[model samples]
Target: MSFFIRGRRRDVKEKKGKKRGLKNKQVLPVKKSKFDSGLDEEITSDEEEEYLKGKVNDIAEKEAEDVETAQEKKVRLAREYIQELRKERENEDDEELDDKAVAARLQEEVLESAGKLRRLVAETFLEPVSEDFIVLKSKHQKLPITCLTVTNDGKFIFSGSKDCSIVKYSIEGKRLGHIPGGRKGTENLHTGHTSHIYSLAVSSDGRFLASGDKGGIIHIWDGETLKHLKKFKSHRDAVSALAFRHSSHTLYSASYDRMVMVWDLDTMAFVEHLGGHQDAITGIDSLARESCITSGGRDQSVIVYVIAEDKQLRFVSPHESVDGVKLVDERTFVTFGQEGSLGIWTTLKKRPHHMIKRAHGCQAENGLPNWICSATTLVNTDLVASGSMDGHVRLWKITVDRGHRKLEPLFSIPIPGVVNALAFTSNGSHLIIGIGQEHKLGRWFKDKKAKNSIVVVSMKKNV
Candidate 1:
């Protein structure tokens, strides 16, 4: 179906602003009396031609100027980016040690410093937009959304529900599909979980998807295909949380049985069980280093376990029930609890460096502080996000410079129901939240109007 049409190029310059009139070249009417007297009217043809030529010249000049300006802007941006990189490299070199005693120490320190600079630059490039955060999209899952996780590339969001199914959604909030749940029946019919799916995790490499259910079962799926790969029994009780070690196949699972178990993903084998929490382990997260952290429910404790040493360290209790735990950095982490307590702890210390007994204001009808059920940290930034049963999602910034750390309030947004899960997109552009009614005893109807839904929040550009 190839076809070619001969066309002439048209360089048309549209007029902008006020229209100019060629007053001198106005079309004159010749009088009949003058024609009868054999008189001829003088014409300004030369002037008219000169005026038209000048107009074209002006338009051409303006277009050329615009093109040059755009080129200059591009070059300026390129130069600034190059300069930033050079500055980072120079800073890396400026920290060189004078001592030749430890060559290994020098090389390691240099690489660490350079890596830090690179991360800082990368974060700066994706700084949240300055505009007001918006509700970009909302998805009704028709079941209580218990957990949600955004993929590493920010293309998809996987949500687990009380119905025991894992539904996948695109970034635009379109339902793509769902993974088949539950055990294979003898009838060869596909079914989902028989219990609530409470925890969801995606590997850092974006290759694997894992979900934990109320029956203490963990299901593994191919991240790209969303196909069920394997299912295994992990704990005696329900699995409360799951986290994958960054850049590794190792996975850490926290269960209501008060056990933290590490799994070898490649072989689907249990590596070891970490026992420290006296009650249910409600929240868990892995650090960039070879370690993981967990928070207990009824026992109200936060435990840090070092994988290399195969031991626990720095056990502390900050509240009655630490419901949410998030790793802010390799050394620092944050925890929130049922009493609305928010605490910042460092691996170097046994006690929390900063604490807020009641971080959120809303209280239940019984005067109990709203429990914070979930938390997540913005990568490469000091910001932490927490969602509570008070129907509010709050953001906080932590400062840890020179041991004088403080938790500063940034902002809070109200949700229609309890926020069960919270995660930031890999690029920090959107916040994916699982929101629904907080199931309560003898309060079945309160959740009737609370449609199970997933909310995607756009962040303030400058945030």
Candidate 2:
């Protein structure tokens, strides 16, 4: 098992070598929380040397103040390092706690929703999402915000709107500038299908931004300069969604044409395409270049595909539960759906660790399927939050134990109305909710002390 894990890690490193000259591979936010064992080991040896030096100071009373100052500085430095790690790890830990609370809430809601007899279900579960949070009302746009990106380092928020423009905002939600893909007010968008802004994916480092449009065009932007990096035409009919492979130059783009295409960001090349779905592909997540990918489509199926030995979509992943996935750890992950369906699965063997059905459905669909309205992954915490047409943003908690897995609905917070998209801050402490087909974009608090009122949202926060 360790070898398998090492092999995956090595694959990522090898791909970095392959990223030369192609599309610039972007750094993804680091998801692993355990302290670096190598660094810890190296620190042990250095600490011993430091202790020996301290012993020398102990024997030489000539410089007692200097020795005391050095000792104090060392200890203070160590504490500061630990605090930084904690800040980084806080989001991941919050996920664990959130999963616990959300799972319990979902258990009850699903039980109740199951009694409603609603079939084709798409239910979202969220918990005490602050009702008193602030919302930045877009004044000059027609399309609601459909997609958003926060730099891995948590510096900025880049939002894509149906208005055919990509807007960059500060981490707090302040609109800094806008990249017009085409006309802002008119429908003369540059998409091959039409001019609507479909979706957007910001690179982990927040240095690159990718947007998909209804016309099957993918635009890449320099996150800092807001300059156009490149434009790639899609083989799919209408580009609906796009995702960057974690820490790599490869990206996955899906479209209404029922195809998923993998692009080599460094080489500006099309690596492969996995086709067979009969409906439009709406949502996508890339775990790695060749390991696994999850996609949700209008066909009412959330499908998983395994990268083959030749680095192609192999169609080996499971399609049973079909819930949207949020990658928590290499061995643990969570999933959610519109029908009150959520599950936790392990890709180590493509099997579910935990499964729940009908968490938000009032009726049974007898088999006709539906699509989740909106879903977001806090890349740092691995928390899977999704909103449904049923007026809820559901959070799923995932527990990753070496070989054990636990996934449960952590909380079911209600939106004032239907939801279009869900996003959490880099710290996983705040949530920005875009109501589906609505004009309001709400900023909310996501903590244990979520009082009825969250912090006042200033459009300048861009969080």
Candidate 3:
């Protein structure tokens, strides 16, 4: 019985060994088939390639983010530094001082330190003798060009003429577009101005162009396209002057009816009307503030209207008739008259702070002062310019020392025509003058040598 059991165990061991050998043979052949087909190598190569591409994309994204962060940090630091400087300046001033006076002084100091403030440097500007000035003219209008306005960017100029036309021109005196004067009895037709165009204004944003005419009509146009958009007929008489408040669509228009009307170009409607002048309102001007300065012709009055408060400040002018007005800054303004005088005024004073009698000198034949028909200021600078029939455009520099302000003669450019309108570019690089044979408002005098055209004077000697 022991021999039989031993023999059975040997048989069982042999059967187990045979089963292990069969399993090993099956697994080895399956592995050899996968390697020979190249499927495993292909999958591994594809996964490696995808991993490298993802890594490269992540690196590029990180670098871009780092660069952007650096730029943002630099800008933030600059803004913070400027704010700190402003705060330090404000703290150094006495708190009891007038806020406007302190702000004005602080602004000048800040702008100067930042190198943003520019003045007519006597050395560079004075060397440009009258002959150095280059004058370019465009003769598209048949009649006198009454008013001229330059866009804030100094790229385009719009001029209104007595022929009931409005002409658009480039800075190089190239005519871009023209709106021909409509025929008589065409008042109802919205084609163009039926009467003479007396005043023109372009908004600071260069989005709206406004023109006032002798028929008490105000037309709004697309500043870039010169397409008429809307018409306003609120004034009862001829609209003489139009001004747009700086950096806004608010418009102030003066008319021969002795009324000043305010309009909102955004809503295309009238805001309100201001009345104070006893005679015709000849000129109007405004800055970034909510106020405007207007000159009353023949009434001998200069009125400042505060729109927000509905209040007006009236000052008596020494001139026979104030013909033109312009704002030098928010707190100060300048005006010219038919008596050939230029008056510098401030909102704080009832009388002119300084006056220059016979600014452009007198007429040779009549022995009377030449009429200063137009005047302009170089935005925020101390530069002022006046135009007349005196065959020259005079520039004045405002000197302020210890609260005392006065005008110092800078120089004059020879322009042989009746300068009915004067406009300065935003950068003070050019002066646009509308020249004509007759005066804008009347035929009081004629310049036989002058042509009915628009003249552009390059202010910079090298430009």
Assess every candidate by TM-score.
0.69, 0.57, 0.73
Off by more than 4 A, model 2: 1-132, 181-194, 276-278, 288-292, 296-308, 311-324, 348-351, 361-371, 379-382, 399-406, 438-463
Model 1 lDDT tens row, 160-274: 8776678888887677877645442321355346677888899888788888888888888888888777777859988889999886778899999999888887998889988
Per-residue accuracy of model 2 over 65-100 as CA lDDT, tens digit each: 555676788788766754554454535667666555
Question: For candidate 1, what is the lDDT?
Answer: 0.72
lDDT of 3 by residue, 1-463 (tens): 6999999999998798887776544434544665466445545778888977998999999997776776788788767755555565645466544445556765875664442454654324553455445454445587888999999999999988888888888897678988888877978864779888899999999999999998899999999998989989889999999999887999999999999999999999998899999999999998777889899989999898988898988889876888878987767789888889998887778888799999999988988998898999887678888999999889898887766678888888888889999998988778888888999988988888887887777776432
How does model 2 fare in lDDT?
0.57
Query: Residue 379 of candidate 1: its Cα lDDT?
Result: 63
Worst 10 residues of 3 by lDDT: 120-129
For each candidate, the alpha-carbon lDDT, in order, equals 0.72, 0.57, 0.83
- Pairs that clash in candidate 3: none
Q: Which rank order by TM-score, best down to worst? A: 3, 1, 2
* Model 1 vs. true fold: TM: 0.69
